[model samples]
Target: MIQKETTGMILRKLRGDRTQEEIAAILGITKSSWAMYERDERVPRDEVKIRIANFFGKTVQELFYTPIEHYKCS
Candidate 1:
């Protein structure tokens, strides 16, 4: 399994203010799939990860490795 940093960012992005279903729709995935991502039970494919990075206006490397303290959505 990957480290929790990625999952943590995702949670920060989705918690309270956003619904899993809404995020899933934005990512072109099913709610259940989004749930898997949230639970850190699965990692998105490379293409999906790229899409997610694009959605957040981040580079894939930044999304995966940048510290949350340094995160910039755009």
Candidate 2:
């Protein structure tokens, strides 16, 4: 079974060697805010979620965790 990665893990992996500061700057948020995101201590707003998803060629639904039952959205 494929275990879904946490938002933090997905964010960090997507970041690769890039610094959180640079990514945060690109997203127009503070460095610490970005760190909080990766630590799962905070949830970014939709705008930030969309920006990150676009940057990684993914949808916002794919970026954040979703309950299995929620997948029925058309």
Candidate 3:
């Protein structure tokens, strides 16, 4: 089935080699918050989403709504 990529996956990919603390500081968020976001344990508010998207130079839709297909073997 096809599923949208989770925000955490997108964040982690965009973050690359950057430290979570560094990204959190740049985005004006706590490292713990960023960690949670990366773990898919929390969702950021719309404003924070916008900030993250802007920091990554991607639109919210591109970052949060992209779809990926994952097939399971029977």
Q: Give Cα-based local distance difference scores for all models.
A: 0.72, 0.90, 0.90
lDDT of candidate 2 at residue 31, scale 0 to 100: 98
- lDDT value for model 2: 0.90
How well does candidate 3 match the true structure in TM-score terms?
0.79
- What tens-digit string does per-residue lDDT give for candidate 1 at 1-74? 45656664665573458888887898898988768777777777889888877877878787655554465798
Off-target runs (Cα >4 Å) in candidate 3 are 1-4, 66-74
CA shift of 40, model 1, Å = 1.1
- Indicate the worst ten consecutive residues by lDDT in candidate 1: 7-16
The lDDT of model 1 is 0.72
Residues 8-45 of candidate 3 have per-residue lDDT tens digits of: 98899999999999999999999999999999999888
Q: Where in model 2 is the C-alpha error above 4 Å?
A: 1-3, 67-74
Estimated TM-score for each candidate: 0.65, 0.82, 0.79
